[model samples]
Target: MSLKVDKASMAFTFKGGMLPMTVMELTSADPERIRDQLAGKLNQSPAFFQHTPVVLSVEKLDEPHLSLERICAVCRAHKLLPVAVRGGAEPVKQSAWALGLGWFPPADGARSRTLEEVPTSDMPEESPAAAAPQAEAGAGRIYRGTVRSGQQVSAPEGDLVIIGAVNAGAEVLAAGSVHVYGALRGRALAGIHGDTRAGIFCRELRAELLSVAGNYKRLEDIDPQLLGTSVQVILSDAQLGITALD
Candidate 1:
């Protein structure tokens, strides 16, 4: 029994791909203020943010001299796990590395389109496309309550509208378009049947996932600034485009 050890060893492989992660942009150096704002945001949908992994962005900070540990601690207090820091100088990076926090390369703005640059005409038109087959004259669905976890609503006819929140773990699907008068924190799929011009609109753009036509975007891929803003999501050039509403 003392000499019966197996000699086979397992090999490890690494596969790389883009991951959508939440980015918490900091505009203030005060930890207390950060806590308060974060708390308010979490309150809107606690289950969604609870224990969520996030990356910190200091690009907007005027006095970015606060302790990195303090920032991470505040995030932890609000149930957000701070995994990395972005857009900081060498000193901040050094501190974050020392504290075992990962560093994320700053995103390039030149290659990306600004939210305002998106055209308003990109929104899914209520009327059917000239070349696409049309739905029944008035086929659509309207819901008036919070779509809780495990709940799903699908409108196979034309459109879907919810007057309440689409909570985390919930889902909404539509053949034409999806509109949510309240917060959208769950999954939304429009043009499920391949309507290339389909769209998704929501009062609060906090959805964990979104899709228009066949283009899909996860929470991390979305701009953090659009979290609480009224937004319209559309598919352009096979890419998901998000535009803030007036």
Candidate 2:
């Protein structure tokens, strides 16, 4: 007879926390009005709105007017998923629960405002009379956690932030800027689409390789003195430079 070995223990491994979901602030008084606005924006840039998941913030909406079913239906019509509801009145919270949507309270010290009260300048500017709209720089998201070896994080639409160590054999890729709050000993590639303006920030820079867009700097290319120091890497005038963080 053969003895049984505990092979299950060897096959299981624990990882860090779950990835955070993106939250979008609705900040609109009339759900129909906001829907129209979003539709118009998407019509102008269909590619930008496609496949982008978002949650709604209804703090700006009054308590008795809007219902959760109506909001979810509107979101579905726009191809946006309403995974969580935020910033609404008590009735709004109840409506969200009725519609099977998670209700998340606003963070502490966060200010609440009405749609009419909020300045519309924060919204993207629209063009008129055959004039073209200006292209805006893409926004980036930051993650504050350790990336273990054999782990990977990728951001295709925007930049990514990591506030933890990137252990050996781990990889991080972003289409925009990449900032690591801790050590970076793994591989990181930024500006994956030739943005060139993308950069890397780390407290301890000892990576095997670093790249921005198509340009790269290998470990052998950097000076030994620059290793293991807090630094910011940028591409200036087609050359990569490491500078001390202020």
Candidate 3:
């Protein structure tokens, strides 16, 4: 006799989600050097090392032995968990699997704009000399409604323009910039693809978190004077800076 199993009670469901992640790019593979540097950084900003999950980018290094375990230990000691590794050799990939960490290939900044050339012979005679504008990096994507709690919106290829409020617990990310026409109460992350030149502009700023490129600042780190005013967040000197927009 076989026991009956309920199909409705399928245990768990799978859904796709977008979460903010940090990347730790290793310039030097020395474990001691990494530990010392992390110590200095922690001293400067204690809140930054809060058991954050990060992906190790080893694209720049060509070391045969990366000391992956020692480096991971140092990061873990500093409250950083290595979730996976990106862009490394075959040995590094095997090492990652041995340590139960995921491995990924080298990823580009973002899906960049694509262009094609049409030969004059194949062109239509009625085709206009000046073509119409397109929705790309400059035009970007526009959202016409509010972003509620737990809702996430992203402009993966270009800018993001929101015409409504972003409630607390919500998140908005853009590859280029974020323009909020209404109140911004949730997290706003610009330059999700590592473009430091991107920025954030809001009509009323009271965001929970703001990040430009990989540099971020929480609510408590934000200036009190810029709480309810129109502001712009930018990356300056490798730090996130918020100032009233004139």
Maximum-lDDT candidate: 3
Question: What residue runs in model 2 are displaced by over 4 Å at the alpha carbon?
Answer: 1-139
Residues 143-220 of candidate 3: C-alpha lDDT, one tens digit per residue: 655665545677877899887777775778887899998889887888877889999999999988888886888889
lDDT by candidate, in order shown: 0.74, 0.66, 0.77
Report each candidate's C-alpha RMSD, comma-separated, in the order given: 15.4, 14.2, 11.6
Tell me the TM-score of model 1. 0.48
Question: TM-score: which candidate is best?
Answer: 3
Off by over 4 Å in 1: 1-8, 110-246
TM-score, candidate number 2: 0.43
Comparing 1 with 2 on lDDT, the higher-scoring candidate is 1
Where is model 3 poorest over a 10-residue stretch in terms of lDDT?
110-119
In candidate 3, how many Å is residue 20 off? 1.0
Flag clash pairs in model 1: 21-220
lDDT of 2 by residue, 63-164 (tens): 555656775677678776777787677777787788888888864331333222324443223323112222223466655455654455667668787756
Clashing residue pairs, backbone N/CA/C < 3 A, model 2? 59-87, 143-161
Give per-residue CA lDDT, model 1, range 1-246, as digits (tens): 386635465365478975545566677878888888888755433444557677787866655465778878988988889888887778888887898989876666541222223233542343232112212336887765566544567787799977767877677888889999888988888887778788999999998888777577889989999988999998878888999999
